[model samples]
Target: MHALSELRQARRFVIKVGSALLVQQGKPRVEWLASLAAEIADLRKASEVIVVSSGAIALGAAKLGLAKGGRGSLADAQAAASVGQVELARLWSDALGHHGITAAQMLVTIGDLEERRRYLNASATLARLLEAGAVPVVNENDSVATEEIRFGDNDRLAARVAQAAGAEAVLLLSDVDGLYDRDPREAGATLIERVEGVTPEVMAMASGASASGLGSGGMLAKLQAARIAERAGIALAIVNGTYVSPIARALDGPVGTLFVPQGDASARKAWLGGRLAPAGVLTVDAGCAVALEKGASLLAAGITEIEGDFARGDLVAIHGPKGERLGQGLVEYTAAECRSIRGLKQDRQADRLGYAPRAAVVHRDHMVRT
Candidate 1:
């Protein structure tokens, strides 16, 4: 099992800030937010950081004088989220601005991450923001996301974002120091330093609700998030965020429970190969088949046929002329666009399409050989 020190070696990270740590009695914790911003500023000197924040509903509920923690009707919760999103974004912008850091807000729903095209778009957007030296503040679209189709807690949402961003690790800073063998409120409960995997026994240790009653996630939700990280070969840790500079403190010592990564496949490959329902199929000629064998990208000149109505970034099965399945990959062009440039060389593709298409219909980096 790895220790908290592993965080020091990671180049990119996704940090989840729960409602309990950011909101108190229905108001934002300005001082704590400032402390967190300072730590993030320091961390950004050597690494890229992404924050998954959850406090809009809590903050909004307080302002609207509705049931706290979104315990009331779904409509009420949505209304509170509408009011809180503005405040949440402003708070993060103000806090990060103090340290000369630009804060970018990204709101998404579960469908955004689950759908291939939207997933790629979201990932690319985040990459662009990070490349420009800005920290992305991601949150679930609670205001419009229905309760039946929403991620009620931010923990699982953070894990999905980590996967999308190809982050090295995830840090879930919450109210508790770490996972305990039992409810920490119990006298005999003890903290577990390292978790090799999220086993049934380990999962049993989690509780349902947070102590602060301001957030929907608890130890159980965190464990679920850890499972996602473990499958994606990303390290994850749970630590207390109540203290000053908690992220810095955790990285300097063994202050949290580290969940070791167990995935044997690359995160991208795992995601690409795991799609059970491919959106379309592309049948390439023998020339393309030969090039693919040499690990070359799938060029437009090699494509013989395109089937199914699919958009760019959608998963498409690649087939050789002999009707044998070559593999599956994300396409770079829509079906209509592919038809306009199929079997055309580089210059011909540009002439026919009236624009230069990407170098490859399916880039080698986005392909998974079966």
Candidate 2:
């Protein structure tokens, strides 16, 4: 268990801003956005900040004169997002600009993180933006993401962003102050300060139901986000967004529930080794086998053969020369594309496919040895 004060010393961090704090009556909360921008600007003086914000669909729905019921079909949400994303980006830019800081919009889909090439590209883009002293405001591409492929909620997206950016922690600023023994709306429900063990009881505290009518997020989503952070070796703090300079205040007071990072190495390895069933198989040459042992990305030139009808981003088994299982990783190319690039040099990828894809068939970061 950790406190928000621990975040003050974190050099790299992600902040998740939910729709509850961002939209009101179908419009952007200008005052709060301004304050949030100021807070982010101040934090940038000492740390690198990445904001994973959730409000496009809500803001879009508001402008479209949708009900506040928070239970719309996927198509309705998508249409709202299509019409509202422009305004959302504009408002964020205007708000941050007031503090002499530039805001960059990054609309990511679930596939963006699942695919090895896109994952690397996104990470590189974020790093470049941060290095140039700009805050990246990340949001899901709700306009095009279908129900099954969606990240589901921004809470999960925030955790993924933290992992991709290699952030030390994620501060989830929501409507409520923190996690409670029961529903906060219930009488005599006390807030839990520091969460160390994500036991069954702790998980049971967060309901699967939505928290507020304005947003799709709930305590369960935050808990899921915490689990992702724990596996990624990063802390997650969930706090209320009612106060002025909430980020600064969160770092100084007992205002939120903090989940400490735990079981990162073992959990990640276990997930890769046991939980995932290989969707495809890649048999590598002897030299490639040796290189993989030394921790190298799986390149097309090294793959002797490909098996299975797997698509890009699907987990694939890596086999050594003697047919021994070496490891498993997400494939960067579909099975069809893999066959075309077999034994081809990295630079020749574009020539073979008529368009350049990633060089590695499987990136090292997504690999796990069993």
> Which RMSD values do the candidates have, in order?
9.5, 8.9
- For candidate 1, list the clashing residue pairs, or say none: none
lDDT of 1 by residue, 109-200 (tens): 87787676788899999999999999999999988888667777899888889888989889999899999999998999899988998887
Model 2 weakest 10-residue run by lDDT = 267-276
Best by lDDT: 1
Candidate 1 versus the native: TM-score?
Answer: 0.73
> TM-score for all predictions?
0.73, 0.74
Give the residue spans of candidate 1 off by over 4 A: 268-370
